[model samples]
Target: MEQVLVEEYRNETLECLHRGHICGVGPDGQVKYEVGDADFVAFLRSAGKPFQAIPGVRAGIKEAYELTDQEIAIMTASHRGESFHLETLSHLMDHTGLEQSNLVCAESYPMHRGSREQIIRNQGHEQRVYHNCSGKHFGVLSYCKLMGYPLEGYEDPGHPVQQEIVETLSMMAELPADQIARGTDGCGLPVFALPLKHIARAYLKLSCPELIEDEKTREAVQKITAAMHAHPEMVSGTNRICTTLMEDTNIIAKGGFKGIYGFSLRQEQLGFAFKIVDGSDEEWAHIVVSILEQIGYANQQTIHRIRERFPSAIRNDAGKIVGHTKEVFHL
Candidate 1:
């Protein structure tokens, strides 16, 4: 069952409410807090990028291509194709000798308004590298190049590269490989579906890798998380929640399409996954703030940043404050 996690008010009367499920898990893989159906199954979408990049890291793609942390960060990013994102991606391809054509993700203009407008002004065409998932594809392709695997069917579930990723996600989620439901992502990559609690567990392992028994997996997690920390902007563009939360250096987070989001706190030793039943992401910041407040998160600076960027005050087309949003859930 879903709970009313946020409510929007216009002229002091409730105008809209968002129902969602939130599940927080501890390092011990036990539920710490929950507000709705903890067992609700949802697709991980791009929220699986970090875990999907694990196989590449394990294959030593970083060393093989002499990739920097910024380059590595892009492999786990849903970047908006801002100028800096393009620059970093160019560097990554140059270093690895990867062609934009190698990425199977469909070509599209930059997701950032300013960047897309700039390209339109110049009459530039869409390119595959501009797709948000291109980095993940490049990471897989790089791994395939290193491992002597065929690149033609790399996106297929039965492909060797994808096989490794499945094993990695299964190990990280602490679930058997066959137990995870599978689906094709918008970018044409295989995506994982699991209960919210297991998704939280996977993020918990991501933030607190010491709990992982396997040494190699721990190292890969460390490298990936550290890359995300060192280059939060590469993980997502400016004003994105993922970059904002990770900028605090204590929170590890990523949001996916269709209102799916996952985050972890190192100090709290907790991981959380939330899904908005209506599939709206507009109130994500409000819900995140409410969660932090309920959990007594100690990072005032991080909370303040989020509130500053995404205040409760709602605005109209002319920027007039006309409404407000408030948290409705207790946990």
Candidate 2:
């Protein structure tokens, strides 16, 4: 394996390095490009939400709850917990006959700075509903309600909802269910561990769901991908890399905890997944842009927008430019 320095951070006169592995796969499950150890195993974290939501969508939760595309997008989100996000979650819970109390995720303040400040100014305490993973938990609850399964332990590996999620992920990844490892997420849901290539394969299926043989799975993937693209804001937020990337190009992207980022290119039917070994979110946006450029998917306009919106330049207290972050990877 070759050394892949994904990003470099410079401050005045010193540089810090971030290294990682990246893998790109086509619809046929063939590795199209790779850097470093493409087989490196890691937890998917929230990057798996879109796939995890497949079972619920296939179970008719979308039709039953009359979920809008924006709402469906939130279901697959690691949102910024903006006011709009909370309102959307509230509406989804209302349709499902659930309440904030029903959510199993731990309480947390909003991830968006403005939302957090507003809540504090209003003397409103943090609630489970404001947690970034609340939408995902709500989707799990909806699945439990639709199937009449016990919602109390829905996050348990033995639970039917979790079992179905695993099965759905397995089908999409073209891997055996038993081969997929499991772990607990920050939101107390079951997260998956697999090779980078398998994760890329899942995203490839998401981009080209028509390639799936099962009618229900295909329909679910199509709906989820459409929702993410149509309402990118619900997937992340106004200033997030995921939202900006999807909005600017024909790619559906998502970022997860521990520096996991994945995206699928709709026009090319390709999927990419990568991990920053140091788990630094700061390098993620830069690496994503670099990967898109390397794969020949980003246009000049898209590159300009990304640079304008996600500048990695270091600035002094007076906002003077001191140094910058740059991509160092060849592919």
Candidate 3:
């Protein structure tokens, strides 16, 4: 069920007033518990990053082509467009003798407030690296270079890269392409369309591809997971939610804009995907932590720690501190 409520309360400590929208995925992995349709069609967004990074590893390009851990990390990232991320992107392009003109993504601002001012003051223009999906674009370039696929139409749905990704996801999820919610990601490549449950299944399958019938799919999953774990930082940045989520809890998690998150734990072999129907991303930490708890990876103590580390929005007004969200479900 999906739940959204308008509740009035006061924050006794901070003394502020505010409104709240709370949405979550509990330990049981229900798509929609309280409100409904939590399993509604979901895009998976950059959460699909690892899937896009697979071809490189499955083909043994990582071993024979000597791809660095850094490159592998970048391949699975939704970076902050920091100086370091941009530098790496440029270097990756240099390896292929290409430049900015080749990117298919629309230009945008930095995801990290950390680099916004410096970018403006120095460059007089927002750089493409700030688009957050630049590393993904660079990954496409790397694939094109490796497979000798024509670069001009690689971003189009009919291209070989898109076809491979679709085929891979189709076989892995045991679903047909038409059933998947295929769409153009913000970064200018075809992204699989799926409901939250299927999205979670995709991640879990990555964690345990032996469950999949295809041997190549199993190897692809293993390679991508190892590469991501080896270079966690490039998946996000210094303290990004995805990067920290991966490093701290040792879970494979990625966040998408407009409130979507997915993760899978290979040992127990479970999966989870959730979305806030009303489209709220501010409560990302709460959603993720609660999901982890539901999966048995965290207890009350861990929940308390995560909450303290990332406080919910509460404000104190005339009488009480107001809670910022009302996602009816709890961990």
Best by TM-score: 1
**lDDT-better candidate, 1 vs 3:** 1
lDDT (0 to 1) per candidate:
0.91, 0.85, 0.66
Candidate 1: lDDT of 37? 91
Query: Which clashing pairs does model 1 show?
Result: none
Q: Give the TM-score of candidate 2.
A: 0.96
Best by lDDT: 1
Q: Against the hidden reference, what TM-scores do the models get?
A: 0.98, 0.96, 0.82
1-331 in candidate 1: lDDT tens per residue? Answer: 8999989999699999899999999878999899999999989999999999998898799999999999899999999999999998999999888899788899999999999999999999999999998888889999999888987888899998888898888888888999999999999999999999989999998899998888888998999999999999999889788988999888899889888999999988999999998888898888887899889999899899999999999999999999999988987
TM-score-based ranking: 1, 2, 3
- List candidate 3 stretches off by more than 4 Å: 5-35, 298-305, 313-327
lDDT comparing candidate 3 with the true structure: 0.66
lDDT of 3 by residue, 260-327 (tens): 77776666667667665555566667666756665567445545655665665565567354665433
**Candidate 1 deviant stretches above 4 angstroms:** none
160-253 per-residue lDDT for model 2 (tens digits): 9999899999988888999999899999999999989999998888877777999989998889888988888999988788888878547778
